[model samples]
Structure formats: structure tokens, C-alpha cells
Target: MAGSLGPGSGWTAAVRRLLRQFSSAQRPGSPGFQGLPLLVEGQQVGLVVPAVARELRAFPNVFVEVTGGLELRGGHCPEERTEAVAGVLAQLRAEGRLARLARWRDEAYEVRPSFGAPALLNVERAAAPLLGVLQFGAHLNAFVCRQDDETGSWQIFMWLARRSPHKATYPGLLDNLAAGGISAGLGVKETMVKESWEEARVPPKLAAQAQPVGCLSFTYEEMDGEEFGAVVRECLFIFDLEVPEDFTPQVGDGEAQEFYLWPLNKVREAVNSGSFKPNCALVVVDFLFRHGLLHPDHEPLYPELMAVMHQTL
Candidate 1:
């Protein structure tokens, strides 16, 4: 979710407005670097820069070589570049410059020059908190939805999780039933299966039944103290898991406080009312449209909304 907080009304109306706004637009406003160059050995290999890291250019040690965009130079190869960047981040952390940054995990995410290709380098996930801030590449999202048959027929209901207050990012906000970043070592399905258990406590037999339902790609910028103007270029690997009617999600690892089974109408109300995290709302919109709940006759911006949902990163 980007730059949304508190509560608002007109859930459905808000959805319409967002559809019209994002679909009609191509890029975010000038807040942070659109695509900062990630240079290695004076050659442009990739892109990565914070949307709003105030001291990006004032690093005391790591050299900033500017050409067309903010360039990180000095490392002889990709691995060397990564070490150099990590060193800078370690220094920042030591100086208390990353209070708002997520807890340092010493984990690395692969930075690719393009989609579905070999990575140019591996960078600390904390350094490029925003997906495209360092323009590393794609982060995966898993959206969990279920079928509601309480009305006698198979109707749709969403299982939404309330993020734990302890979370460093978007704590206590609404989130998908089971979601996480696709870490460097995990494959897509492996990630989905792991999160299903770790976040929602879905049993293996039930989790194995989960199905892939395509993906939603989008880029968003947020205004926050830690990551101002951060751009997230993400591809959500949406999944649909039909749990037994009586199943209730229990918090497995404290990522979520609890889970709620929401009727489709209530889901719509929450979305319009801004009760859901911003990006989660986008996932819900795609689910609704895919299930034929959002139609052209009712939503004048239906086509545009769909277009934005499937935009190429």
C-alpha cells in the first residue's frame, strides 16, 4: 500500500476513482528518481535508487558517480558492487540513519537487468526497500481468496489478514490472507506454499490445492519518512485457495493479528472505505473483475481498470 492511511468512505466510489486515476496515467509525479542507473565499472547494467532517501547523495564513503542518472561506481564486478553498496548501508545503519528502514536482515535480493533474466548483482534487500528504488527487479505477492457457500450456492468471500502491530512495514493495516516477498532463494510456488503455512497456518494437504490465478503488475510511489518517493515495481502472483467452509485462519508466525472472512459486498465496502491496504485493494479489484463482479455497464472505467491491472512492468 502506498500513501494511504486512516479511514475514508465511498469504498466502491473510491475504487472507481482510483481506476480512472491510475489507468489514465502512465507514471507517478516527480517525487523520487524515476529510474536511477545502477552502474558497474562505468557501464550501466541496472537501475536502483530510493524514491525518497534524504541522504542518498550525501553518503560519506561510497562514491556516487553521476552520468545520466544516479550511478553507483567503483566495484570491479557485480559481486564487488553489491559489497560496496552493502558497506554503505551498514554505515548508514551504524549512524542511526535508517530508523524508518525495515529491520536489517542481511538478506539479498537478485537484481536483474530485465525480467526473467540473470541478475546483474545481488543487493541487500534493506538498501533497496522499494522494488524499483534500486530498480533491482520484481517482488512477488500472493493473494489468498476463498469461496463462500453460506448462502447455499458458491459465492465469493475474501479472507483478509490484519497485519500485526509489530510489523515494521504497514503494521496493523489490512493485507491479503497469505502474502510475503519472494525472497532470493525461493521459487514462486515455493513462496506461496511457505507463506500459506507460515502466515495463515494452512495445512499442507489444503495448501497443496491452491491454484495460480495469473499475476498483477504495478508501480507505486509512497510518501513516508523512511522511503519518500519510493517506487515499487511489483508483480503479484495471485493465488486462489478454496478452504473448507469451516476453516478459520490462525496466526502462525505473528505476521498477522487475525484473519476475517469477508463477504464480497463487505469487501467492496471496505475497499471503497479505504479500510484495506492500497495495493491489497488493487488485488481485490482484480479478483472482483475476474469474477465478473465489476462490469462495464456498472463501472464506466471497467476497461481502463483492467488495462492498468495488466500493465507491463
Candidate 2:
């Protein structure tokens, strides 16, 4: 049946559409286009939109408008840069200049020119979009496999979590079993384990069994509201964990309200219906591709989809 995916397959269309939304920010002259390259230590580390740039201009000593773009004042080391930026962010928050900063988690995300580069500075997680800095996160796909007694075929079931309604973003949307942003001092695997335990009650021993898969990257622009024009450049590290069939995920930290174990087809349907949070849906799609549920022969845009998921941002 997996071989039947070919031209005109409806299943692949939804996945294609979702991927397009994430890639929209990359389009030439798209709305809320990154206003200027944000440079730190002579290297482009992020982007600054005009609104953010205007607010930044007020802090002349900390932020300077250079020939090509915006740059942090010179002679400041990474620690100094972080302190200067924190002061500016705190002032802005106090004055209510940037509305998004109100959601501050008091958590810091390291700013780097690239994924593995040394930290240029550390910024509040909520302010990442405003700065257009690349953010990193870890997502775990927890699943269990069972054999059909009669058909002798293996079926995979994934655990999906429904976000708590009171959440600040994507409230009540379906999400991966457990996921979280990598805080300034934590490693990728450590964050994954912490989030799994905090959000889904997944024991550390079991979470440690998760195997590291590849990653997905995308640049997304806020379309409207207070954060309009703010960009989110993110890379999510994906992990696959096979849980025992009897294991049931419990609500650990109130982030997730409930958990459901559904077959791959049902999960795909939710993705098509847009029930899953946008980024979580992408993670699930990557999982399906890796597990052989999605094939190139059936999906015409297979190559493009694969490429877009790993955009060189």
C-alpha cells in the first residue's frame, strides 16, 4: 500500500502545504522581510526588522547602525555584549516598548553566527524572534510498534500530547510527546531529557533511550499582531524513542494536558487537518519519512520537501 503513493496523492499535499508556510519567509520581498543583517564581532548573527531597529537605535552606545546593517558597539566581549543587551532588553520591557518581551521566561538562549559556533551573547528566549537569532530546540517522537497477529505486519503508534489551554503560544494544539528550547547552559540531549520528564513524565532512563535523528530548520516570519515582522529562525534536533507498549505518558508539568497514542495514519490525518502545531507537524512529517511511510516514488515533491526541511539558515 505504501507503494501506491504517486502523482495526485492527496496525503502528500497537506505536508507540502505545511512546508510551504515555513518557507514563506525565504521568499523574495515577502512581507516582514528581515530589515537588516544584525552583526556581532563582524559576523552576521541575526536580523533586525525596522521596528526593532528603531527601538535599538535609542540605545546608541549598545547598538550601532553600520554601513551594511546593525551591529553591537565594538570592544564588548561575549559576556559584555550579553550584559549590555540584557540591560537594553530590561529597559524596553519596563517601558513596554516591545510587547513580545512580556512573555519572557527568564531563560537565556545563546546567540551564535551558526549552530555550532561559540556564543556571541545570550538573549532572552522571548526576544529571539525580535532579534531574528537562530534558536535551537529538541523534540522527541515517542512511539511503540506492534505486530498484527493475522496480517503479520508491523504497525507503529506514536504518542501525541495536547498542549495545555492556558499556554502562551499555540494553546491547546497537538504537539510532540515532549519538546523544549535549549537553554544557554544545557546540551541538546540534556534539554531533551529534561523536557521529556518535565512535560510528559517520561522517566530519564527511558528518555535516555531516545536515538538522535537528523534536524529540521526553517525561518518563519510573524504575519500580524504585536510581533508583526519579527522573524523566528530555528533548528530543531529530532529524536526517536521507542517506548514499551504498556508505558503510558502522564502529565508532568502542566505543559501538556493529556496524551494519546495513535496509529501513524491517524497522526498523519491530524497533520493534514492542521491540528498539530506547525513546527510539531514538521517533526512528525520527518519521522514518517525516516520510517518509510513517505516515499519519493509516490510524492512528486519529495526532493523539494527534503531540501526545504534542511534549509541552510
Best by TM-score: 2
Candidate 1 lDDT at 208 equals 68
The ten-residue window of minimal lDDT in model 2 covers 1-10
TM-score, every prediction: 0.79, 0.93
lDDT of 1 at 2: 11
lDDT of 2: 0.87
Model 1 misplaced regions, further than 4 Å: 1-9, 16-35, 40-66, 98-103, 130-153, 226-228
lDDT by residue for model 2 over 1-313, one digit each (tens)?
A: 1222234335666867776788777532656455688899889888877788899999999999999589987337888899999999999999988888888899999999998899989999999999889999999999998888888777888999999999989999999999999999899999999999999999999999999998999886774365546878999999999999889999999999999999888888888778988999999989888978888877777888787788878
**Candidate 1 weakest lDDT stretch, 10 residues:** 133-142
| Candidate 1 lDDT, 1-313, residue by residue in tens | 1111223356447867666544432253445435565454454444444443236566624557465555565376778866877776777678876553556767677666445766656766655543253232211223334434564445566788898998877788888888766667677777777888898888767776777788877655444474543445666777777677778889999989998887677777877877776777787887777677776666665676777777765
